[model samples]
Target: MTTPVTIVGAGLGGLVLSRVLHLHGIPSTVYEAESSPSARTQGGLLDIRDYNGQPALETAGLTEEFRKLILEGRQAMRLLDRDGNVLLDVPDDGTGGNPEVERGELRQMLLDSL
Candidate 1:
């Protein structure tokens, strides 16, 4: 029989770990200090890279759900000078392997998946 796992937090890492373990028929319990998922506001944008976070989500079987939370046009970057001159401009051509997603939304998605 597989022993149950205990996770200390509900952050991305912990949630993802729980998810992956669950996928393989393992049981896990996540313990978070927060009273609830919405206990407080989470951070802002997170760049989920193809090499790391994307594969983790895929292993959790939440790639489609994660894709839905991606904010379009966020991959674009820009830089302006003091004189309001554009120093750099990078458009979001939808080719970036790293997509920006709201931290809170991602957390909620992971929580819901479990």
Candidate 2:
């Protein structure tokens, strides 16, 4: 008998698990509550952690595709106070791999890769 793993939600974690399972020739289904892909707007960008998110993406075979979703110059993050004054601005010199892309776009890419 073969055991099955059930996953809920199509977010980053769920999608990543699905992809890896597929690579291993394991069957799985993703249960997303959303009626449609565009049912709701995804959250803001995410800073993928080097040890966690990045490695998961690599395992899911979406590293290359995910790279495309990387918004150019989005890495230039800024820290602002309540007054909305420019407290600090860090320009992305294309060196730091950490990128800031819309969560929806990234999710779409991950789903497509799977």
Q: Candidate 1 residues 25-58, lDDT tens each?
A: 9999999999999889999999999999999999
List, residue by residue over 1-114, the lDDT tens digit for candidate 2: 556778899987898899999898888889999997789888897877667777888988888887787778866789999999999998888777566667998888877867
Ten consecutive residues with minimal summed lDDT in candidate 1? 105-114
Q: Which candidate number maximizes lDDT?
A: 1
Q: Write down the RMSD of all candidates, one decimal each.
A: 1.3, 3.1
What clash pairs does model 2 have?
none
lDDT of 2 at 100: 63
Error of 1 at 102 (Å): 0.7
Query: In terms of TM-score, how similar is model 2 to the real structure?
Result: 0.80
